[model samples]
Target: MAEQEHVEESRKDVLIVACGGSGRRVFAESEDILEAPVVFINSNDSSTIPLVPSGMEGCHGDPELASAIAFENVGAIREAFQGYKAVVVFSIFGGGTGTGMVPVILRCARDCGCKTISVIGIPLSFESARRKLAQGALGKVSEASDRMYVLDEDSVVRMCPDARVNSTFRMISHSIIFTVKCIADLLSGPFFSTFFDKVYTFAYVSEMNPVKAVEKAITASGDDPAGGIVVAVSSDLGEAESGAIYDKVAEMTGMVPDIVRRNDREDTKMVVFFSVWGA
Candidate 1:
């Protein structure tokens, strides 16, 4: 396969919006580390000012009636999202504000000619009503978004077997943040510059070699090898070790990947982040 080098402009027009109380909570926890500008849309006018970034806009409507209100006053929401090329929307799919407003927000983004990515959190199995609502909302989201990442609460729980409720919630939040960061890093960071239509992401920690790690991450991502792949490795591996992993990925994907390496002092295990992008 011929190596194709496609360099595009940096993703400076990216906008990250958190669409409900749960979304805002995750943003608040991760705002300090996030690299992109963020907007918070909520239903209550409580004390979110402290959680939100200064100078950024926050839209408040009625939580129970967010969908109606948003549809009625879409001009205002569209104005808020003006001047963005790509939009990343974060929300929990089961709640009233998050569920109702996500589709509206996604529609607005799409109408504005912006690429839209929705990161939606699914409710736990015990919350049957919430799960049902999430299932209903997911259809609308799928129609509205160009790409979607569904974070399953059950999968997170399985990952953290003995964790408490609060810890599980934190774990979920962290996973969302990590995903958003990885996407931003791949699109906007100085490492690589290819404009991709869809991205599939998966992360895994293993003691195996880089080829096995790539295989595991690819299987977990559930992405077909039809487009370019970007890999980020976080480990204490030396230069030669890292190069070996990169070579394995290039061999498997038949394309030169955008690679990012990080040194982890405390852990010896390699954590590989795999992102497969659609052409």
Candidate 2:
């Protein structure tokens, strides 16, 4: 781990991986914003997009089956993830495939010397059975990950109050894509080693003004950024705009922010990543 941290330019690429049906659905819609090579691993060979090995089977919502399938195909997982400096696993936890296979995948990525990060969504409060399963599976997932960013499914409703359920889920998936882009850009830079092992919560804001976007995300997360914070913005911003973002973040967190630049197209999108204690 120590040797992997200090290298300057070698570990630059990030592989964006989507696990299971829910994750693949989101990935299919948000490909344009992903900004990296994207792939999937599923229990069943059902997706239109080619699976990593073409013959991997589904787990039928059984976590034990999922884990066994992942273990049996460890070679394929390692081969698919090889040569990337970092691997970002995307899944909606609580389902059989996600809860069962994600930790195993993370461990494979780490074993192959890639920094492992999981961007996962938890079930809504009303999903009592799934929620309980998600909580139980979280510990294994957390242990295998270098950094994990959580998205609460309930927050999707609050984020888009009146939209139809499908539209709201699409919006939330876009937000998740934006966050993935931000983290991928950050890993390409020199600051990744600073926060290697911790839990974080993320938010996406697409306001034209950088300050307002950052402020809104901070307020929404309700997490103190003092421990550490990353504010990622579009690479197209002007010097003044970038400076204003830096100033706003420093004012809020009382610490210099790790700013990452990306090609966020027309909208000035900002994704804020902040650490959470004991989560």
Candidate 3:
């Protein structure tokens, strides 16, 4: 079991891929955002994989998934991740860094003989010109990562009662934080009971008028809800108006999400991940 201290770069190796952090407009004499250290907290001292926030190069505004770090950091990541059995990547959707960086990190992990799974949040709402950007990047991401699990907010909102947009965003954030924290807590606790074999996820899509299709599918399967993170991935969207769909989601779920959009070919898909915790 690894100690919880910040070890030197000379120890084990686990790579963290931070995509294009070049978004920040650097002043001539400004300090660099890429220079920020990546932070990691393991679920337990025994579990091999260490969870860390992505380090980007040009980071600013919404540090959740902005900026770009270095592929050079991969060496450090590998060293840190060494001795761990697996890799857990928490990332955002179809942006310069998260999408771009995750693939690179996964490749490095694969080369290093580590099993990699990218846990991403795909866009489930109409916030911007999502069609143009997110799809292309996701194509690259899915091609690289093994077992890509996505959570979409678009379909998740309908699961909730009526709620406002702001409230919905908060709700979404709450779930994301909840799921991550829950896993962390379990790992940290004095038990190896339920995990190392738990895989539960929800998918949300907002293309081809799939809402009715969704209703029918859920009705058929009798899927119930226990709120958590919704990873939404989509590439099959037509011309979408800004924030219209997401706003509707806000009204329906009483919780909104921080949307991460991915366009993977013609398949515009969304996945919502939630949890029903044990007492």
Best model per TM-score: 2
Q: CA lDDT, every prediction?
A: 0.64, 0.76, 0.40
lDDT of 2 by residue, 136-238 (tens): 8888888998889887766556554688977877768878877776777667655456554388777787787888887777766654654677776776778
lDDT of 3 by residue, 86-130 (tens): 354555454444554566666666766765655555555574444
- Candidate 1 Cα deviation (angstroms), residue 268: 8.5
Q: What is the TM-score of each candidate against the true structure?
A: 0.67, 0.82, 0.45
Cα misplacement distance, residue 104 of candidate 2 (Å): 0.4
Candidate 1, 232-266: lDDT as tens digits: 65545567766776787776667566556532232
What's the TM for model 3?
A: 0.45
Per-residue lDDT for 148 in model 3? 48
lDDT of 3 at 58: 30
- Winning candidate number (lDDT): 2
RMSD of each: 7.4, 5.0, 15.8
